[model samples]
Target: MAGITRRKRRSTTRPAAAPVTPVADLIRRDFTAPAPGLRMVGDITCLPTFEGWLYLATVIDLHTREIVGHAMAEHMRTDLVCDAIDLAAARGFINDDAVFHSDRGVQYTSGQFRAALAEQKIRASVGRVGSCYDNAVAEAFFATLKTEIGATIWRTRSQARQDVFTYLHYYNHTRLHSTIGHNTPAETRTNHYHQASAA
Candidate 1:
């Protein structure tokens, strides 16, 4: 210990409230769907700025690995997650048999989000705590986002939001994903719909 520099200590606990009814890990790392909008995974990530932390909540279509909905806010409240879910539902991303999966973050477990899911007829699926694999696709998306966005420290929340907005548009429209066969998420989705319509 004479000259060794120890790494800074960080808390391992995820910054979210506990579940109300102890939801089950319905996803169980499947992270797949034969069709678009059938299975969706949602998660929250933090964007740092001098003004404060901007929490970005996102709902991703597991079939195409596309961000179906996103909401950026100053706080990670239940409303934030609800807004993202509502957007996805309004855009017809949640089919009749679709399942919306997430970790049991306090926001996801809140009564508001539960009611929102009921309103959209979407089943709520949750994963066990500390199991990233259960929501791996969402986790991977955030990682890719930060990596591609350069992870720069922003001056304000609006600045970070704008950057994320542009990047998400590019992500859905242009950026190719190896997981989805090196095709853009939008392309994958469009191809599916076009083929279905053609048949």
Candidate 2:
């Protein structure tokens, strides 16, 4: 008979570090009712695909609940968020004292991402770790996206990109939000501006 050897399994225990309290403070400081272009919420979410999961980073204006900017990337790097921020800035979303709020994900805390905000005079607010309630608005938008778009496994990144873009256009200009009184984001913003002018 041949000799058999056995190997010992190693424990997967890890050290527990002190809780990060700054994240909670940041969330509390940033959470507020929406004012046009003054506050924005952002987050990244994953979508399944046959090739791999697609990551989407989105920035939405809390006033109209409009997804003002977004980016899709194969990697959830800082650049993914930077791209969204750049898009929002290009669309004139960045004004003095604007605040960009997101979870304490490393991507959001990266130097490059922070630098961009600093350059635009925008403040960065990070939500507490493991607390999704801090970013509930962004999460709710993602849920609405998944529900209305109908999840599908993408065969390629390009396909996912196209589908996401199409859905975003519809989301901004067509899909009605109950919170905004069943008005699309675009419509809500327009109506707001018109009412302000009339008043």
Candidate 3:
């Protein structure tokens, strides 16, 4: 198959070397949420750019499949994940009891990220190593993003960032999802709120 080719980063990822707080897998792979803000999954992916690699972290709402928060940077340090979560909080999409699910990546397991979650009053849920099913929704979103964005290496980091920004806007506003009755994520969330108010 003449499929799109993405630039592959190194396969091996290091576990957090220092002792870090281990959060329970509260989600247990159940991605379906009763409401928009109650559950979220986050992950990081690398995009190849001519200058270097651009790392993107995202927080996605389970109910609407909406990317409520995102952050992009050259490094995949723990701050990248923290920035994404902070954006979700700033956008008012995260609730105190929200279960923020993620894989056991070093960034998610770092002491800094755990502290960030604590400060936000969001519950942290981490899946075991080598368990894609635990964070399937986030993985699915990255797959869709890579598919739509295609495989060609971007000319520059700025170019990659701009393209991602455009794509995310289209994804959140225009793309219809079968999961939420063929509604765009924004539409699904809006309709949910409207329905809740009516009730």
Candidate 4:
């Protein structure tokens, strides 16, 4: 018999990556804040297009349910999430020591994202693994968005981007939210600030 060897099959699965540092479940299923810029949640979603998928990262204010920051791109890389956070921060929507909660996505758990949060003086909060309830608010937001957008697919990414831009504006300034007593997110924020100043 001639000596022969068979090749070993390589494993296709990869291990789950842990967070760079210990982060707590700060939100703890209580997706509420006494005021704006105190607690926030963020998540990423994809839009279908003939050109390809358009990825969107959004930072939502917990109190008002407003998408204070967002970024869209063709890739769901760490930079995409960071850019979202940067936008939120640059707009002065995030306050120092504000808790930003997200699911345990790779981009959210990456060191680069942690550094970005640190740079903005925002504390990082992560939901429990495999628990959709842990991040329900952000999850629900996407569900509402896709349902309201009423588009199965777009002709191009550019078209998708434009529509998303239009949608975000409507969501923030026009759409009524039952969570905030049927007030728009912008209205909720403004009302809170106006009441605070008057008091």
Candidate 5:
């Protein structure tokens, strides 16, 4: 009895999934909107830490190039993206019938996330399969984050989350964006509202 060994369980393989019919590509690579709340793009990226992986989901406003909302967690579930959208909506950053563009990731395509967007009155837009260019704005944001955050790894997820929080604030309020005439996202947004009010 002391030397007895348990048999290894056989692993089962799942059948390949069918091709997903993605949501319409409403963006068409335009990646721009006349106003802040009309259009947005979101994507998820992973951060490495000794504890494990920390996942971040971000919702960015197209007009000001501002990261309006973001959520960080240990998992990349639909809830993570939904939480990001909810934050944007809660902050009054998303407009009625606004469009949210994302790649055809399962989390973005899943019924739960679509329902969340519908609840928020946000239209869902997805890129074609395997086409990174279709969601270039979101991809560029993550790339810039990786480059500017300058953290290859962290000792813990808490540290990673704190660093990301700081970076997002700096990105919105301090860092200048060349696409927006070298203005910070916060400044661009403020200027837009100021101009509109004066008009």
Candidate 6:
């Protein structure tokens, strides 16, 4: 006790840091439609399987929030996007004046993809590089698909493919979107056509 000195230790606890918010300037602005059928958005998202990854490409009608067409493949190539576009055209959702918007991904900017759009007489619009908001709706859909239906890992590609097909059907038929007044895309499109006819 004669020469004992006790020093108190500092507390190890530290205050939690504030959550990071993306800078407003860094956030990309959403594209506005010039006219119906004049603007569309497209994107690709990957689904994981125990065996491998499955890629999904989609073309959505901005006016109706309807997925005009989509395609899934074992690989993400120019053909994936082109095949979706072809399906959309076959469904009569695309026109010569349609403006196709997508992020500046290589698959979209590749010569083969450009050629496909050009052959259809559709104009290509590229979003700013590395900006997710520029294609926010498409991103949102992918997020929803992953959260609501897609599994993190499937036992096989066949299972993943079946699940993807089922999810797409529900997405196009049953998913209610707040942006479209809580209506499914198909219902919204039908209502829009009805209103247009009445007008």
Could you say which candidate leads in TM-score? 3
RMSD vs true structure, all candidates = 5.4, 9.7, 2.6, 10.4, 8.9, 14.6
Candidate 2 residue pairs that clash: none
* Candidate 6, superposed: residue stretches over 4 Å from native: 1-28, 31-36
Residues 1-199 of candidate 5: C-alpha lDDT, one tens digit per residue: 0112223322111121342554799999998899889999998888777787788999999999999999999988889999999999999999999999988777888888889999999999987877879889988898888777877777788888888999999999999999899999999999999999999
Cα lDDT tens digits for candidate 1, 1-199: 0111223323222635765666666677888899998899999888777786788889999889899999999987788889998898888877986799998777787778888988898888988877778788888888788777875567778788888999999999999989899999999999999999999
lDDT tens string, model 4, 1-199?
1112322322211223965577899999999999999999998888777687788899999999999999999988889999999999999999999999988888888899999999999999998877879989988888888778777577788888888899999999999999999999999999999999999
Give per-residue CA lDDT, model 2, range 1-199, as digits (tens).
Answer: 1112322322111222343323223447344445567888898887666676678999998878888889998877789889998899899865677888987677776677878888878888876767778788888888777666754566677777887898899998998888889999889888877998999
Residue 65 lDDT in candidate 1: 88
Clashes of each: 0, 0, 0, 0, 0, 0
TM-score of each: 0.89, 0.83, 0.93, 0.91, 0.89, 0.81
Range of the 10 consecutive residues with the lowest summed lDDT in candidate 4: 1-10
* Model 6's TM-score against the true structure: 0.81
Report the backbone clash tally of model 5.
0
Report lDDT (CA) for all predictions: 0.82, 0.75, 0.87, 0.87, 0.85, 0.72
Write out the backbone clash pairs for model 5: none
Stretches of candidate 4 exceeding 4 Å from the true structure: 1-16
Candidate 3 lDDT, tens digit per residue, 87-197?
Answer: 999999988978899988888988899899999999989888888898999999988987886655887888889888988988999999998899999999999999999
Pairs that clash in candidate 1:
none
Give the TM-score comparing model 1 with the true structure, all chains together: 0.89
Answer with 2 or 6, whichever has the higher TM-score: 2
